[model samples]
Target: MRRTTRLTAAVLAFLSAPVAQALDTQTGPVRIDRIAAGFTDPWSFGFLPGGGVLVTEKGGRLWYVAGGSARQIDGLPDSVPDGQGGLLDLLIPRDFGRTRQIYLTFSKAQGAGSGTALASGRLDTEAGRIENLRVIFEMTPGSSGGRHFGSRLAEGADGKIYMSIGERGDRPAAQDLSRHNGSIVRLNRDGTVPDDNPFIGDEGAEPAIWSYGHRNPQGMAVDATGQLWVNEHGAQGGDEVNRIRRGANYGWPVIAYGRHYSGQKIGEGTTRPGMEQPEFYWDPSIAPSGMVFHSGSGHAPWRGNAFVGSLKFDYVARLAGDPLREVERISSPETARVRDVREGPAGGLWFLSEDDGALYRMVPE
Candidate 1:
């Protein structure tokens, strides 16, 4: 893979400019105010019905946040934290108020190996615990190695749950329909494959595949218009933010704008007629991990912008417009690796720090 030099201080400083008066909290762009701190390897979070937040730590712990205080919640299962495996994503069911259901994705140890696992349970808010926890699904048996656990969950307007599985460091597996690895799988709310899936009876294919040929997709969200969007890490310098579609092929090892870590060109080339291109991509790799559309009162001017976490860049990026026309990157006050970004119930931007493990709330400043 080609080794691109790091950005210079001057260049980084220019990119980290403070919000101007025109975009200030009262009249200018959106601003963020830090509210809470001190978390370890925070990964994903979801808001509770009453007014609390449920957060997951990559180190295998879950916490409940309310009124600026955080407390560990019991009833979490065992998780494999080796390599890139651990508690990864969390979400509240659409009928959360009625069913009290919560869903999560994590790396589970199967014998001596590990694979991604999806599970759900009831959140007993009054008791501050999870109940009736059960494994909904596990990656096809016998897969090992931890580089790619494409784990992100999104519930579509149609009420189907969509989950992404990484290629597990196996390039060709992405093109293989027989395996669930490296594909977007859609399931009914009860964890069964939807009968209307595209690959129902093809030879050796999993019926849950909605789209194939994806790398490690970590960020996923549904927009107001009900369109699903995904952000994935590229090989060396090609990080992409794509608008996902059913029955589509997102060229991975086959075609990439990025090169290998050894500086070698990846796949055949960047463009292929059948494969769909990303709506927006970053060269020199920001190592984007989490993404969410910004729609809150705190940042009025940025109401429609997309806020994404940058691990390699050590900052948060604000992408504006439908085709993502404008780009504004901001450095986090903590200067730690940003693992996840989400909109809080208070219309503020919530972020998790990967390295220092702290939870930060960004409100309009």
Candidate 2:
């Protein structure tokens, strides 16, 4: 039998949390609460400073969800919703209360080409619109086609923002530092280059690049100790979870654990000098995306564990241990294509489903 677990009235105004159905999980019995639905390719979401939630849809739309209701947020700029482009990731800066600013990753047009771009704007809650919208960063040498737009945002404690850019189906582009493709970028909160960035002073190099040679890095997070990690998608197989190292090369085209979609071999057999290997990898390609490292008392049993949403596997993988193993597979009985997994502000767990376009929360039953 299912039951409703109600939070205090104060908490209700924040998330509108309601009791849900119990399910058997590896850790224990838990309940899942449905947040808001009726989304069209909801790519990412984050908490608003005012206890609401902002969801970015791939079709150039943003929805403000709160109190069991949703409102369409206006002022979203034109973004191409192609193969893998559109409004991707959204983040509320830590200083949101003071700044009332939020960041977004979207695909911007460049001639006949498009590339991932980052923008920030002031959220005018009273008017339900964004003001002063500006694109702060754009991947250069924009390429045609939208097979890979690797866009995820994570803010460092230093108040700097980090983002991932895909190679746009151009394998060789990842090896070139002059172009922004296939790289992790660091920028000042205002979209200016960080002076200490690895390539800042180098001639003919992309100054925003913090790391290179990645293939569609879709998820990034910073742990409590300030360590950064990324979950990347592999071509046909070889999805990887890696620890981000400054100025390091991930050896995408040169070395890989997976093969080409045409059944051809890839790279120089997965070992190369000066190339960083993944801390963990999936051979058959789970098509990993959203990720978060859980720690805190709200979900005590999940503390110190890492959760990753699997696009191809239709489940969420709970990974633990230094070597990083998938300890549990949290799957919705109805086969949810998990797109994003996040650690809620209250220490609970939340995820977005692409299959049904619904938001769900996992909590103690």
Candidate 3:
């Protein structure tokens, strides 16, 4: 367990608002609506090309939502669903019209061992199945910790896919460039290491390593400028939002704003000379999971803000600032745990609840 600084009782209470003051919106205030229900620990959701959505449940199930009906997708790989290990992120290829490809990350089990795996397949919407599924990448061997599988996938402007891996709860692994755990990795759309990756020619290091030092990163998005951003769970209170840089080291375990759960300080101190500082951090631990940049036209002033989902605080936060600032927070009354949030394809917003397992759509009122 890690130690986190406690927030003031008043601040904690303020975060529990059902409906707070509305921000200046181009089209008035925003409201959220329930699109569907009856999800069992839903982890992530992705919108398809023509008004359908694919969702993954933590208990090894994939579902298709269309015409207001939820149907379980068939032909999914065997998954290890134990203690935060299960189906995770989902991404439809940017060129899906031409490629017909979909990517998924999940925990695979073999005997008593489990590790994260990334796979891609051609999705057959009419047949309601995934075809030609293939393993694109797998975590390193002997690293089987159930926690900190910081897995998220996003395609970069260069058409390469970027994946984030946590340190598997083993802090020392963050400094090990030779391991894929605790690193941001870049791979070609076809699952090969890009020749231009930061560690391309390094002998002992994985060629896909982009940046290192991360815990369980649940939220990741690339902005219009092609800059990558991520939000990760900190030990106790040091939940951080960071701008990912190529070849740079983000100091975790070694230097963190958070303490151990047992009320002990972590590593040496909070600030180190070479380590990058977080743009924004939550002291009492918001338990941020999903994140996306608000680039849709439905919310005018929100175009540049980053929206983050919180588990511990049960709110969606809007973060602003070139250096990142907490502009506002919107609490959800439906559930106490928000698993994921994304800007919808139709200029609205979509989010998933981890507890009650429901999908919500937000639009300008």
Candidate 4:
């Protein structure tokens, strides 16, 4: 294969003031080209088994892109696109080849409010539509606002689906196992509670909960060893990356390294007696959105590393080492907000810019 990153001395352009050109940086001299466009706050996407990619826009529309073109896919459930809540992540199941199915997380309309809902649909590529769309999971006690709807999905190595649900702007609910809010939930492919889930036998806890006490984890990626790692947003400055454990409680509102946006201390100090600590945290917050644990050697420099999209900094953080130190902040040609980042289908790196409503691929020059 060709080298993916070339060394250069010029600066990469920002997405907001895009020059439609590539820039050079320390990581490598890279070029960026738009793969698709016409998006309204596109959140996440995944490659299809046969070909093409499926993208979910926050406005509840799903699009299928192939051969440099994109089209809206029908048969989606109506979504409540209020504030930060809307259609979020797209998951391509492990058995996608046998079943042309995809899983989606969105803000579902509940009784008098909205909650995070997980649904699956069959992508009929030939007809450019979605079929057999069904609801698999929904968060309990839907909240009214749209502040924290953490909806990121990743299929684990053990044939189970892992979901990250935010606290729904409800700080206390994250500590309550009775509700699915503010949790890392594990479920079967059919949307049933996995028997191996941590709360399976709990008296009144939600059976789908795998771990609890998460703030607003927008990104989750299973590492090479099948370990689940999540990056969550802190109040003001405490964005965290934690290695997820079964049944473990990651302190959200209770113990956090960040202070409230209004300049107030959050819950006591940073350290609590029983709460799990983050493997890595950003002091001022990178506003982490998407993540991927790079495994293969397709890109020699990224092997065994993790790449995370930073909306605040408009760059991708390349993390390495056990403690997971950010080794480099890889800038893109477009300075627009990087909403999502993933390993590209052709082996380099792919990212979505929320500002420009476009998708770009980064490859070695």
Scored by lDDT, the top model is: 2
Worst 10 residues of 1 by lDDT: 1-10
Candidate 1 ranges with C-alpha deviation above 4 Å: 1-31, 296-298
Q: Write the per-residue lDDT of candidate 4 for residues 83-191, one digit (tens) a residue.
A: 9888889999878888888898999989788999899888898787779999988989658788789999999999899999999999999999999889999988899
The lDDT ranking, best first, is: 2, 4, 3, 1
Task: Using TM-score, rank the candidates from best to worst.
Answer: 2, 4, 3, 1
Candidate 4's displacement at residue 322, Å, is 0.6
Clashes of each: 15, 2, 6, 8
lDDT of 3 by residue, 204-254 (tens): 998888988787788999887989999989998899998999888888878
Better of 1 and 4 by TM-score: 4
Where does model 4 exceed 4 Å of error?
A: 1-22, 333-335
Worst 10 residues of 3 by lDDT: 1-10
* Candidate 4 TM-score to native: 0.92
Candidate 1, residue 246: the lDDT equals: 84
lDDT of model 4 at residue 23?
Answer: 66
